[model samples]
Target chain A: MSATEEQVDHIKQAVERWNAGPVAKLLAKFPEQRAKFVTASDRQVERLYAPEAATIDRYAEKLGLPGEYPFTRGVQPTMYRGRFWTMRQYAGFATAEESNQRYRYLLEQGTTGLSVAFDLPTQIGYDSDDPMAAGEVGKVGVAIDSLADMETLLDGIPLDRISTSMTINATAAVLLAMYIAVGEKQGVPPEKLNGTIQNDILKEYIARGTYRFPPGPSLRLISDIFAYCTEKVPNFNTISISGYHIREAGSTAAQEIGFTLADAICYVDTALQAGLKVDDFAPRLAFFFAAHSDLFEEAAKFRAARRLYARIMKERFGAVNPKSLMLRFHTQTGGVTLTAQQPDNNVVRVTIQALAAVLGGTQSLHTNSKDEAMALPTEESVTVALRTQQLIAYESGVTNTVDPLAGSFYVEKLTDDLEVEAEGIIKLIDARGGMVAAIEQGFVQKQIEESAYRYGQSIDNGERVIVGVNKFTGDEPPTINLFEVPESTTQRQLDKLRGVRASRDVARVEAALAAVKQAAVGSENLMPPILAAVRAYATVGEICSTLAGVFGEFSESTN
Target chain B: MNAAVKPRILIGKPGLDGHDRGAKYVAQILRDAGFEVIYTGIRRSPEQIVDTAVQEDVAAIGLSLLSGAHLALFTRVLELLHDRGADDIVVFGGGTIPPKDIPRLKEMGVAEVFTPGTPARQIVAAIDDCLLHHSVM
Candidate 1:
């Protein structure tokens, strides 16, 4: 064995002794504790483990290096060694102007990329002045009403230089159109623009609730974007199949992988069924996951997901390109793990979680602010969150090597366990006639619900200890700075929207809307007409309302 | 204490946050602890929540939120319950509620603000106590 392997083995033995010593003794004394250790899927588990048997072989065979099928080690061959993961910081609040400043601020901070957070109105495809948008227009995220807002949001930031990620769904096409319009104004060609639109709507139905139309219409829009982006802007990732929201909503690491992959496969099936080749679009498909407090579990989950996805793409879809099989994902630290009780503790939690994401080999990461449990992270807090990642990359030795935990007995075992459990779920999802059918029947939602409930029960029963929450109670609470949207900013945005409306050719926008409606009803793709509307400076609300009229809204079925 | 009388609770999201992690986790624990849990998926308005509570006849309503709009959302739901004549249903909440807002939530007729790390059994027992005391179930 190499010296590194010898050291890994030595550490593994010590860990085994430690687990058997205290943990085993504890388990022996408390027979009831065994039940708590077991996951919802009932995997044989101890609180901690040593790398051996099932895990080591799996790691060596699967997670060896990148550019290989079943890419368990890293997605790209050189990983950060070739190019560092995109330092995409999630930003945006209130008006486009304020959000513009924040975007510029982040860019100046050496942020490799920008991720936009849209308000509820924009997320659900409503104008800032709409009745449904009252009190919510600029509360959570930036309110993008039209091409005007998009222009202001990307004001000084050159489209050619920086890749932007917008966290929008439901009205993702409308937002993407506005972005494309902005790129056109900036003298950047459609093909020159590179970014991602988080157009994952299935998760909206299952977890997030930002959906405007029902599942049928939602899938149509997603597939349309996939088909459109494939032809128009091949570099753009049309959809970022998200497990982050699902995991944040209280799923186990395994459930996150299972449900997320299920969601991705559903999208792929939709696109292929819509008449796109598997390899043509699969390479640009990206994923988003949550990095929680469980370091090894989170790392293992990533490796297992990559391996499982590669196998699925190769074996199921018969994809020939190795890139098509690679599971390139973005991760954000779990917002659910942050606590408002002892707000300061969240910083430490986010740091640890960010470390896990780095160790797990995420393509990009966004660390949650400490005050996120209370409100949208303040500018200072958000900066701290960014610095947390910067610190990990610069100061921590973790980023120096690929899959640093590769040979660890415990990590390997956990990876194997996660794979077995997640694969079992994927099989069940397949057996149930794929993810869409499973979602319609509440199978995926039901599993996530059960896992979430059990985790809550554990914390309640003292089996799982959330520091400064269930245990480690604090007496003195620290005062925190909170971010708030000014009502005046909303008014300013409304006025700017009005000015755009007054200047833009009204007849042209009407024509554009008519074209979008026609395309939506017909078998034609919506992106081109949507782009036409965007070029005509059609308002986001108007475009969405037209679609809503045709596609109708989604009313979720109850339990 | 009869085996036939399993404690039933309705865990739900009463607004547009779309985050159901806490609600789901709590529901799972209550199920393992032997309770019937009905989880209504995300974007449930205040009126819908009260209506679901009355129809399901749950002992308590566990509202979950991660979005900072809990104060506005939870209060509106409580007010809706009062309007709908279902104010008798025990209402408690769990999520990323700040310490400052806990007292406010209580004042707004929330029985408890079960913040992070509060044991699931404790929440379950609290519901049982509320149901027994109010004689609602």
Candidate 2:
């Protein structure tokens, strides 16, 4: 379906005429924003895209009907026409009790799902009372040390009624176990459980550094969860391989998809090697991506990721399940784009980013609060963020049709370019012996570092305009009151941890942790012992420390 | 004083926050600015930070945190440095610290607190001034 030379010459003549006529006149009168229009990834955006610019020579081959093979238009047959995306605002801070209150408030305010944010201690598998957890008990997100905290965190949330997404990695096994224990107490069976655990640890080694164990054990734990979830929690999304953190870590959109999919390949390869059928696990595999401010590029990124992943699942993995080929993803608005200087501007930024996610056909979305750049968003800010999504869903009328921007010349061209670029990067990663080896060799980190450095330089050099920071400078001090975690939160969490230790059957906890250690030592699935430990009220640190003793802690080699 | 003896700086993350882009950028910029910088990577405890500061024999310590635990973590680093009688090492802060906390941080013996959007050159200059003032004193 390649373009004919005659058609290419004809389109070229028309483009040259238009460029020399109206475009030149307009440029003489009013200059463009930049000399050369480029996306955040540094890809040049042509002034105009026509038939020749787009890569889809045969529409049926590149983008078939929606919900068909190579689902470039979208994953679902009726995206948003059937139902709006699940509005899941990521929120947590202070304590489980406090975070639970926030969750209830959001649910009442029309949030369709829950996305939990764990504090540093909870994320890295430390108890609230551990010396490492000292000032950070519940500052960033909710602190879930044991089943007690998990139960409190999800006290009134009906497990069967709503979907939950836990942004937990490294210690995803422990958190998922605690969640299951909580669900069991709520009278919900494992098969009825529905949620996603961000169990992708390769990104932890590459971008976000919350890893507890080495790569070998981390992949094993992930494989164990994949096996466990396929058998037990059939409806649950086992692993949300994430590019959100990678994007936040300053990777380009293509790198975000490339590195994330490369990690996905590693996970799927590991699962297959461990004897799990591709269809059994691939359907439940989900992705998490960041919706940055670039509206069209972000939308195209989503489309390209879907098309690329569909091809990978079908051609590479020999997946027969149609559901396995669909790249269902949850998107969170970019937090790094929120400016601290003019905090109010973040509302508009978040609105645009959320709209991009909607147009990109996200399965679920989390709009960041305006005040996040300053501090944890206040309730008012969070409500505004949620309302932004609602406005897009109901009032915007973009949801009336599926893949509204699918055939636009610019979008189609960008989507094709993104797919090719990302596929090229993935090929390089494959050549480097998969994502883990590449990460160990600092390939991924170096790419992200160079991109981050370039982005910063662009901002510094005035090539990239950050509205409030660079162009529209303002000196008004922020008047919004930030949500502050009280200093006593640490002490209160410590007291609660002490109380749990006193009340729990210490012998049972010890036995459960010992079993967890034994499981870590052997090739047995670590989920059962971890679940047993969580049920016995063993703390996160206790379980992780046992595994740490066996698997050993990862000391990153600094470049 | 030997001109060849570069002023070594220890860049430490003294809490559970894993956002190290700012710290890493600062480390690279400082290294380019002719300072030997040792980054303690992410999620280092305050004790570990202080120990690294001592072991590296750095003239200044730059602490970066985005997890909103700056007050407690910075206070612990300062206290530990005092405890170890290494208070001569200049301490500065970076990463998402609110403007209101900047004064308090400075009052608590932090030489400066570099917030978001701060250029690498500004940080390098601040470190240079701190080192120069420390040598004179």
Give the lDDT of residue A228 in candidate 2.
Answer: 92
> Candidate 2 regions off by >4 Å?
A1-9, A20-33, A53-56, B1-6
Q: Interface RMSD for every prediction, one decimal?
A: 2.5, 1.4
DockQ scores of the candidates: 0.41, 0.63
Give the chain B TM-score for each candidate.
0.90, 0.96
lDDT of each: 0.82, 0.90
On residues A358-455, what C-alpha lDDT tens digit does candidate 2 reach at each position? Answer: 99999999999888876888999999999999999999999999999987878888898999999999999999999889999999999998898889
Which 10 consecutive positions of candidate 2 chain A have the poorest summed lDDT? A51-60
Candidate whose DockQ is highest = 2
Q: Please give the lDDT score for candidate 2.
A: 0.90
DockQ (0 to 1) for model 1: 0.41
Tens-digit per-residue lDDT, B93-121, candidate 1:
88867777789999999988887666666
lDDT of 1 at A365: 91
